[model samples]
Target: MTQFEINSDISVARCLSPSFYLDDVYFESSRDHIFSRTWQFAGLKSDADNIRPVTLLEGFLDEPLIVTYDGELRCFSNVCTHRGNLLVSESCRGASIRCGYHGRKFDLSGKFLSMPEFEGVRDFPGPEDDLAGLEIREVAGLMFVAFDPAGSFEEFFGPTLGRLADFENSNTAVSTSVYEVNAHWALYCENYLEGFHIPYVHKSLNRELDFASYDIRTFRFSSLQTAVPAELEKDSGRRQEFDGKAAFYYFVFPNLMFNFYPWGLSVNVVEPLSPTRTRVRYVTLETDPSKRKTGAGSDLERVEAEDQRIVESVQKGIGSRLYKPGRYSVKQEIGTHHFHRLIAEFMNQGGAR
Candidate 1:
């Protein structure tokens, strides 16, 4: 077993070991030790459908789930209890969920309703006959589910929960896109944890923000990185809308980003496909149409392309035999350092909390 240790002091700490990214053993370990125990964005909430089926972290954890809304929203296993068959094929309104294989029935609340041709069986319907209900939390019009979360929802999202209040019922999704990157999922997230590469990788985005005043704040399970518009640096009066902030980037461990811009929110969900391949889903919601194409949020696809290029290059570099872990920049890489520490803490723990 390869153990990862990141120093507590930023000035003395180094990045996560290259083995953590390049080794299959570590990748497999994280599937249960890290991703399985953290909150993940299932999907955006919708009133149009009463029962929505979602596969949590498809291609990775691959846990099938169903989010049903009666008067309130709840999440349950999409698998049938009797024969382990899938219950819901798609999102639709129905009075009950019946297993196609055995006709084991479950109500919207995931309680066992009835089963056919089982009258003679003793102790047939018990606690295990009902669908397993999982823990779910709603934040900013997005639904997040966890099998066994290491911490409470408030501990994970408390620092920035108030910042997203206005978007609770108002996520007007304009577009959704998926980008495939031939790099480790953590590499993509590591690149996102800092603005140090913005000047070198994202020339267009670098021009929009004041790099000197870039701010980073880390919480127990989340971090915030704020960028100020270059124009706002000149005239501080116009920056009052969102405290003169051009972009509010919030990263919730282990793979969710809530990016708030003047125009709207872009929710980025990073899904690990394999040790070297990852899928990034971009959900673009427009909150202010007038502010579109104006600031740090504009031309997002181009920015993503630039990020992909550099991250892929790093993926290749880390595989070299002579390569070694590098030190972190105390001022510019706090978010990245915090993320590494959390990964180390979870990997070293005995089991999920």
Candidate 2:
């Protein structure tokens, strides 16, 4: 199997093969080749303040995990080794984790503790008996977990998180919405990669931004899309109070969006359910209540509804036999092109492109 190669030059690169979004085999292969090998959110760092069990990608990867704060916070497998039982079922501060099935015990750090009725057993305890600790990290008060992570946390999210360090602190009042949509996860992501559809599809949004000045900036594993407000472009002094005259839309590879506005940050996590089903979540953090309903970030629900409609339409359009590979609009679709390149790079692993 040869690795998938993307043409570095966007001028001639064709769009990703439609089969990448339509095939069940390709969808399943992505579980290991992509998702599992990448970092994922495991709720906020506050979830670890009190030991709690958190499920990673509940409807997909479905890994049972937990975070315990024993003076310091640490993440570990929620499963007990003695018998396959969930060790902290709910959120609570616990000195140690205990399995209800066999009364097997482990310390907060996932070290093996004494078990019942094993007095005379040979090779009483081994490394396998201890709970498995995962590769976990906390960035800007958000908890991130990964199984067989491909690289360091910085490698996965250096640009987006680093850019927010000066402006934000702990996440406060995070509003989350999770639901399934009838479309490939990648399809929904590509829709977000470019601002090209905003002027045509988002009527209310079009009034807020100066789409002519909108630009897509690419990073190592992420891309930034900046939108200058029409009013700010006309009067710069008017937006002097905000971070910048433009709204920042950042997309982290695979499935994460860090959208920053004058109000705060709106985080989107895309979880795939199947070849044509996906789970989308929105986590919003507001720093300034005054900026909630103004500028580019306002009317989020309306924009989302519009996006859902068009992306689902595209999902069906791509399935048509008459449809063939498309070309990228070099000026506006650079983000989508970068995404396709990464997708191809991963998909080609362990198989032919």
Candidate 3:
């Protein structure tokens, strides 16, 4: 029941309290307070079937959902209204959904179609019998759904749309990788919000990026960090078309990372399994095959290994009785500070809608 607050002034604002990461109470509460209210990565529209089942936020929210496309794509509760049975267990081509449990059925749009053996039932097949619908937003070829979003999809992703369109499209080669971390989700995210530790933690990455020109820009529900290629990379003519930029790392509030490199996009969706455990899914889209192994995006595996090592150590350190919340480096940690402030604001809100 504790409300967290972060100082607005980065000059004096301490990092988000360790309690936010260490306490079980906050972790459970965040399922609704933070995650549910934010837009979550659903899946690629290109990969969806006429009827596909998706579990929103997987281990976190775990809301069983069915994405259907008749003339248009839509989302609905995968649970049947009659007896709460699961409607669609997997992706299939169908004009309607039939609950294998009770033989109840609904159309692709989630409207109640028919209920077998309920011919004489009182108040039978009313609106309550219809499947519950949810809102979905499609960006590029990706799909996102929210149970109760705090803001519009545009507000959450608009800033990057213009630039994203150029690099992400149907032709991109998509792949997926997942890493389980023995650390709080916030630790991993905050680590990504700043480049301050690059020189200290990632020697190889540091060599490829111009640390001096690293820039962070904070938006309403997201933040962007641009890394300029090192002189050697620029001289190689690899980053010429990008006008000296090597990477575009984007963080959507709560837990979504859209990292754009010359090769393609790497999306990290942070899933909370427990207070001490987290799952980070890497959805990679290769736009330019020739550039896949070049620039800052090339050595992702090494950089990720290094990051996991450092963040896991911080996880252990924060649990120490002697440790306290630390202050932010105003010049280097604006993105991190902004993230902490958003966490405080969302966590302090009333119960989730």
- The candidate maximizing lDDT is 1
Candidate numbers, best lDDT first, in rank order: 1, 3, 2
Model 2 ranges with Cα > 4 A deviation: 1-5, 47-49, 167-171, 350-353
Clashing pairs in 1: 239-244
Answer with 1 or 2, whichever has the higher lDDT: 1
lDDT of each residue in 13-54, candidate 1, tens digit only:
988999989889889999889988888888988788899899
- Summarize candidate 3's per-residue lDDT along 1-353 as a digit string, tens digits: 77788999999888888899999999998888888888899988754478999998788789999998876889989999988989888789977888899788799999998877887798876898888899997777778898788888878775776666775444788899999999999899999999999999999989889999999999988999998888755376655566678888988887889998877788899888888899999988787889877778889999999999999999999999999888899889999999888889889983233
| Per-model CA lDDT versus the true structure | 0.88, 0.83, 0.86
Ranking by TM-score: 1, 3, 2
lDDT of 2: 0.83
Write down the TM-score of every candidate: 0.97, 0.94, 0.95
Quick one: best TM-score, which candidate? 1
Higher-TM-score candidate among 1 and 2? 1
C-alpha lDDT (0 to 100) for residue 281 of candidate 3: 93
Give the poorly placed runs of model 3, Cα more than 4 Å off: 167-170, 232-239, 350-353
